[model samples]
Target: MKSGINAIIWEDSANKDYGMQNTGLKSPERTRPHHIAVLAYQGLCLFEFATVMEVLGNRPDASATAWYHLDVCSLEGAQVRATGGALVEATGGREALLSADSIIVPGWRLGPVPQEITSALLEAHAGGTRIASVCTGAFVLAAAGLLDGRRATTHWKYAGTLADAAPAATIEPGVLYIDEGNVVTSAGSVAGIDMLLHLMRRDHGVEASNKVARMMVAPPQREGGQAQFIEHTRPLKAAPAIGAVLDAIRRDPAGEHSVSEMALKAHMSTRTFFRRFKAATGHTPLEWILLERLRLAKDMLEYTDLTIDRIAFEAGFGAGDTFRHHFRRIVGASPIAYRRSFQTV
Candidate 1:
C-alpha cells in the first residue's frame, strides 16, 4: 500500500472517536445513547438489514447504562417488501433519519433511488449524521452524492459497476471495508458484520465491541483483507502441482520455501512457476506467502499471549521490526492494537 493509503487505514484503526468533527458534528458523548436509523426499502436485503439490527440494535447487557437506540425507517409508508417475500413494517419514516446520529443503508437494489430518499439523506448528512452502507447499499449513497470523492467499496462482483456509476469515488474492492470518517462502506454480505463490529469498537470501546462479537458468535476482528475472499482467475485444482506447493506452505508457513525451491519441488523452472502461480492464485508467490504469514501471525496474536519477537519468529518474519512493519502495512494496525482489539482475555 502507498504511504497515504496506509495513513488513512492507520487513522481508522487507531482512532476510536466517531463522527465528522470537521463537518461540525460533535463527537459522541458516551454518557448519552446514540441513535441509529436503519433505512428499510422495497426489496430489502434481508441478511444485510438483519446484520445491522443484530449488531447495533441488540442491547449489550442489563448492566449497561447507555446503548444505541435503533429505529427502522422507511420512505415507503409503513410497509416495505423484503427479500424472500417478507413484509417489513417501519418503526418510523424519513423524519427519523434527520434526528439520527447515524444512518445505515443496507444492500439496495441496483436501480435509481427515489428522490425523497435522496433528499432526506442529503439533508441528514449535511446535519452531520454519519452514514454507512453494506454491499450494494453503496449505490444508494452514491446516488445521494455521498460517496463521491470518498474511498468506498462493495461486493467484488459489482465493484466495476459501482466504479462506473460513481466515477468520482475511489472503489477499493480488495478490502473488507473503508472508514472515511463520516462515510463508511463495506463489502458483501458477511463483511457487514466486520464493518459493524468496527463501528461498535469506534462508538463504544474494544471491550464493548468484543462483548458484542461474543454475543453474536463472530470474530472480534478479522485478519488481512477482503482480497482473500475474491475468486482467482483459475482454481488451484487446475495446477495440481502448485496446489501441493500451496498446501505445504500452509502446513509450515515458517519454513523457507523460496521461489527456486518451490519451482524445483513442483518440477518446473522458476520462470514457469511464477507465471503459473499468478494465474492460479491471482497473486505472486511472495505476496501469497506474506499474506499467509500475516494470517498466522494474527491468529497467534488473538489466541496466544506471545510477544512480538516470538510471534515474528513463529510466523517466519525473522525479526520483530520487520514483522511490525509488514503487519501495519498490510493489516492496517499494529500487532498490539490488533491483539487489544481482538483478544478476549
Candidate 2:
C-alpha cells in the first residue's frame, strides 16, 4: 500500500505519491493531516505568528506528504495590519474556528478582545478542538474564561498582571509552557517554538518532529516545564558590605553557611543581618541559600555527567534524596529527567 523513497518521505509506488491516485486509501486521506487555524489581528507579534506558520505550514511538497493545512484567519475575514507594518490576507474568519482541529492565538498588543472571537473559541473548545496561546495571548484565553482554574503562564513581566486580572487561573511564573490536554499556554517568544514542537511530537511522532526541527535549526524538543529565563535582580546597597556575604555564598555553595555566621562575617548582629539581607536580596537568608544551591545543581545537571549524589553534595544539598525532592519541587522534574529533556547532548 505504501513505499519509502527515503527516511523522511514515503510514497506509494503502486500509485501516484500518497495523496494522488490513492483515493481508495482511507488512512492517507482521512487522517494524518491536521487542520490548524492561526489567529491574526492588528498589532500582532510577527515573530510569534511566523513561528506557528514555520512549524505547521511549511511542508515538503504537496505530493511528498501532507502534514498540516494551515488557515490564517483574521476577525471577520478582513485584512489586518501587523505591528511590523505588513498587511495580512486571511483565508477565513470565525468559520475556520469551527473546522479547525487546533487553534493558536499568538501574542498581540494589550487591548480589549472582541466578544465574537471569544465566543468562537468557546465553541471550538466545546467541539473538542485544542486551544493554545503564545505569551500575552494568554490574556485572550483568560478573557474567554477558558483558562479558569487552570495552571497557565505568560511572559514573566506580565505574570503578576495577568494573575491579578484572572483570579480564577493559576499563574505559573517562569515555565516555558504548560499543556493541560485541551488547553496549552506558553511563555514569551522562543518558548512558542518549544510548545509547537511538543504538539508536533504528540501528533505525528519524534522522527517527523525532529525532521521539522532540523529544518528550522531548532532543538528537537524542550519540555514544557523548563524554567523561563528570569533574571533575579540584586538590590542596590549603600556599601559593599552585603555584597561580600553574597560573594562568599556564590564562591562556595557546598560550604555550610548559616545566617549567624554570615552575620558575623558582615560585622552585624543577627537581627540586623536578617533585616539587611532581606533588603539586599528581597529574600530571606534561607531562601537565598536554597536558591543559589538550586542554581548550581541545575548547571551541573545540564553541563556535566556527574551523578545525582555528587551533584547534590557539590551543590550543598548534602543528599541525593533531598536534592531530588527540591529539584522536583522547584524545576518540576527530577535531575535526570530535566537533563534528559534539555541537555544538548
Candidate 3:
C-alpha cells in the first residue's frame, strides 16, 4: 500500500492443485515437499512469526501433499511465550534446522543471542539451508555471522543499531527486503509478508505466488526495491510553492512537466527549486514524477482493461516500449505480466 498499489484479486488457475504444470511454468524438481523451519523463542514477535506460517504453512488452498512442510522449532523449549503472554507449542527443536531446506527467524528480542541458536543456524547454513530473518531477527543472523559482507535490511528504526552490530554487513534501510542468494533479510513487521511472497514466487512461480497472496488478500508482487513506510522529514515551514508543484504533477502525471517549467511554476531558480523539492519530498523532482507515473500506470494495469500503449501514454511514458522498459526495471516485472498477476477483473 505504501507503494500505492491496490490488493490483487485471485484468478482461478486451471489447475486448482499446487502443481504448476498447467500454468506452463516449471517448478524446481522436488520429490518431496520443501521443509521450512520457523524458529520460536521467548518473547517472540507474533505477527512476523505468523506471517511465515500464513505464507508457507498449510492453508485451505494448499494441499498437504504439495505445500511446504513447516515445523515450529523452539529455541527455548517446547513451550515458548510469545508477545502479549501468548504461549506457543513448537513441533520440533533446533535439530529441525539441519534438515530444513529453508529456515525463517522471526523478530528477535533485543540483546545477546544465545550461542546455541547461533550455532544451530550456522550449521543449517553450512548444510545448504537458506536462512531468512524478519525485522530484528536480523540480529540473530548477524550474530551467526550470516550477514557479514552481504546486503541486508531491517526496520528503519533499527537500521543504525544493526549497522553498528554487524559492521561487516551492508545495511539498506529503505527497501522492503534483500535476498542475498542463500541469505534473505526483510524489514520490520508486515514487510515479512512481502519477503515471504517473494520466496513463494521464486519457489513456485508468479501464478502460485499470486494464488497464495490472494488468499492473504495482499499484493502478489511488491518490488523489493520499494521503499519502507518511513515518513518524510518535511519541515513544517517548507515552501508552499513546492507543494503546489508536487500536487500539480500528481494530478496530471501525463502532462509535460519539465524541470524548467516546474521551477518557473514554483517561482524559484532551478537550483533553489531542486533543493526545496528534495527537502520537502525526499526525492528529486524527476524521481518523484517517475514514481507518480508508475503508480498511476500500475493502478490502470490492475483495475482497468486499458491497452499497454494507451496506459503507457496515459501514464506519461510516451511509448509502450519505454513504459515496458521502465516498468520491468523498477517494478521487476513487465507491464503485461503485472497485469496478468494483478488484474482485478
Candidate 4:
C-alpha cells in the first residue's frame, strides 16, 4: 500500500483480468467451452469437482448467446474414484490436459499427487494453459514447479505445506482466492464456486454468472475473502419457549432484540439462556447476529441496487458508520470495494 492507488490498482487489475476467464454458460456446440479441463486425480474432493462440472458443463439455453465445453482429464484411463466412493469416468487422459484453454486440479487425495500426474500438469503449464487448484490441489501445482515465485493461496490448513514445498511461491493463507493471471488457487471446498463464478464473470459478464447461480439457487459472486461459512447460534431448541424466541430473531434480523428481553420472552433466566446459546451454536447471540448481518450485507451487495446506508438498515446495523466498521472487521474489505468487486453494478 506504500505505492500510489493508481500503481496498486492498474498493474494488478490487468493481471487479475488475465488469471480468470469467466465464460458464461454456452453451448458446447456453439462457443465450444474455450476448452476447460478438470484434472480428475484419485480422491478428488467431490464437492469441488461437482462445482466445476456444474458450472462449466451445462450448455446454455439453445436460446442464450454463450457456451462452454468441459472435459474431465486424468493421468491415465484410470477410473477416477472420489472420496465418497463415487466413480467418475475420465473421458480423456494426459493428452486432454494439453488440449485445454484452462485446466483445474481439485484438492488432491490425502497424499501427494503421483509423479505422472505432476508431470502432465507441468507439460500443460508449458503449453500456456491457465491453471488453478482448489484446497490442496495447490500441492499438485506446486509439486509440478508451476507455483514458484507467484502469488498463490490454498486452504489455510495447507497454505503452509505449499509454502514449504515451493519456497518461491508467496503464500497468502487468509484470502479466498489468488489470481496471478495465468495461475490461480483457492481455499478449500466452497471457495471453488466463488473462483469459478469469477471466471464466468470475467468471460461472459455479471448477468451471465448470476443466471447460473440462480439456476443453482445459490448466491453468485461471494468475494474470495469472505468468511467460508457463518455459524449461527440458534436459540435453545429443547425449551419450546426459547424456540419461539429464536424464530423471532431470524424473522426480524433488523429488529432491536436485546438479550435480556429475549431471555424474558423465552421465560428463562438470563444466565441459563446465555449458557445454552453458547453450547448450541459455539457463539453468543450477539455474535450470531453479527454474522447474520454480514451475510445480509453480502446478499445486498450482490443482488440489490440499494445505497450503502439503506443496506446498513436492511442488514440491521445502527447506521452507516457502524455497518462499515463491522463489515470491514468481518468481511475484510470496505463496503464500496466489496460491492465493486462482487456486485454486477
Candidate No. with top lDDT: 1
> Candidate 2 on 1-345: residue-level lDDT in tens?
111111122111111122123223222233456888999988878899999999877565557666787999887448888886988889899888778888999995787888988999999888878889999999999989999988888887788788987899998865777777678888888878887876775566666778889888997755334341454444567247788888888888778899999999999999999998998787898888887888888788778888899999999898899998777766655688778855664
Error of 2 at 46 (Å): 0.4
In model 2, residue pairs whose N, Cα or C atoms come closer than 3 Å (at least 3 residues apart or on different chains), thus clashing, are none
Per-residue lDDT of model 1, residues 1-345, tens digit only: 000111123122222332222433222446567788999999999999999998887576777664688899999879999999999999988778898888999999779899999999999988888899999999999999998989999998899899998999999887778888788999898889988987876676667878889998998876545554444333535489898888888889888889999998889999999999888887888988887888888789979998999999999999999999888776656789778877765
Model 3 CA deviation exceeding 4 Å by range: 1-26, 59-64, 223-228, 232-345
TM-scores of all models? Answer: 0.64, 0.68, 0.62, 0.60
Q: Write down the RMSD of all candidates, one decimal each.
A: 8.2, 10.2, 9.4, 11.2
Deviation of model 1 at 270, angstroms: 21
Q: Order of all candidates by lDDT, from best down to worst?
A: 1, 3, 2, 4
Q: Report, for every candidate in turn, its global Cα lDDT versus the true structure.
A: 0.81, 0.77, 0.79, 0.72
Candidate 2: regions farther than 4 A off: 1-29, 60-62, 223-228, 234-284, 292-345
Compared with the true structure, the alpha-carbon lDDT of candidate 4 equals 0.72
Error of 4 at 220 (Å): 2.4
Winner on TM-score between 1 and 2 is: 2
Model 4 vs. true fold: TM: 0.60
Candidate 4 residues lying further than 4 Å off, grouped into runs, are 1-31, 62-66, 223-345
Residue-wise C-alpha lDDT for candidate 4, range 98-153, written one tens digit per residue: 87878888887756668898787777777777788887888888888888988887
